[model samples]
Target: MYKIENLSFKYEKDKYALKDINMDFSKGDIIGVIGENGCGKSTLFMNMTGILKPNSGEIRYNDEKIKYGKKDLYNLRKKVGIVFQDPEKQIFYSKVYDDIAFTMRNIGMNEEDIKKRVEKALEAVNGSEFIDKPVQFLSYGQKKRVAIASVIAMQNETVLLDEPTSGLDPRSTDAVVDIIKNMKKNGTKVVISSHDMDLIYEICDYVYVMNKGEIIKAGNPDDVFMDEKMIKNAGLKTPWIIKIYNELKNNELKNGETKEETNLKTIKTKFAQYK
Candidate 1:
């Protein structure tokens, strides 16, 4: 759905925020960007969404190069929704319904249609109860959901979420996870940048490992997360699921069980615990 080639960006001369980056979002149910803080994951997203133009190289969405012109950006953003890490930055209205309706109103959508979209969007994020509540009265996680519902109300084909599960209790995190999965089930492509390795491992079919302003590795999660030493070398943590699975694999086999049999049983049990 998206392709970036040799992308580079810098805020100041000779100081690159992102350098020589190439990523293909051409295939995957969920695509993930994993890196340490300030490692250019967010910077890359900004470029992809046209918030920042690249210093060099090209970003293409659906076989067309991003033009960065006023009308081009308007259409692009309309199709690609972005949810930043901080909900407060995105929440403009004090009331939940108003905040979610802000974007639709800006586009001159009729009040009746905006109301329907807002209701559907809130329902998608499981935030219908808080629709009439004041934004300040909601918890951090509730605000986050409201922020996401704002974009969902726009009905974008693709969603770019930066740290979707950051700073949330387990229940809230689980709720966000379910919403993300449902997005895929409903046919919206989701790309997320997060430091949470377990979230990436659990949801992403494909992953990119980034450091020092470039992607060092890219592949299916099974192969990518399987290499703990590599992840540590890249200055990132291994997913807990991978760590446990590797530990289990290292221990000696018992009861004359075949390796494949043991792996199937153990893997299923571990995955079920997370589910």
Candidate 2:
């Protein structure tokens, strides 16, 4: 639904926050951008979502180039929504229902439709109980869910989730993952920016590894994560599943596949004596 070509962004005279980045977000995929802190993952998201224009390249949404004019951006943002890494940056309303309804109201949706959208968005985030609660009273995770609910209420065809699971506990993170999957099931393109490798490995259909504001590797998860040298150079570690398969199989990449189930079956064969 989105095409980013030769995109580059600079924050200062000589340094680029994002350099020569290109990405495609099809209608039904979970794309992951993985890198260390200060690696420009967030910067890339900003440019793609039209919050920050690129210094050199262009971004297209649904085959049309994105223009940053006031009216242009207003319409673009309606199709491409983003949830920030910190919920505070996105959550502006004191109450849950208001926050989720904020975007729809901005577009002048009737009250009845806004209420139904609010309820459905809250349900997707598993936050129905929070609909009437004060935003300040919710925990950090709950606040994050509310922030996501606000974005989901927009029902954008493409969604950018900046560190969606950051600072979240396992249960909360899993909830976020499930919500993301549901977005895909409902036909939204989900682009995730995170440093968490395991989460990327498990949920992402594709990945790009970045360092120093440049993407050093791009491919399906197996090709991107299984390259130990590339992962190390990117200042990230392979996911635990890959690590286990390597240790159990004497560090050899087996049959050119590193998926969880494939690796698990390999590990089981090594300990077949347990049977």
Report the number of the highest-lDDT candidate.
1
Per-model TM-score versus the true fold = 0.95, 0.91
lDDT of 2: 0.87
TM-score of 1: 0.95
Worst 10 residues of 2 by lDDT: 253-262
Q: Against the unseen true structure, what C-alpha lDDT does each candidate score? A: 0.89, 0.87
Clashes of each: 0, 0
Q: lDDT tens digits, residues 118-217, model 2? A: 9999999999999999999999999989988888899898889999999999999999989999998998889999888988987898898889998898
Instruction: Report residue 267 deviation for candidate 2 (angstroms).
Output: 6.1
Q: How well does candidate 1 match the true structure, expressed as C-alpha RMSD?
A: 1.9
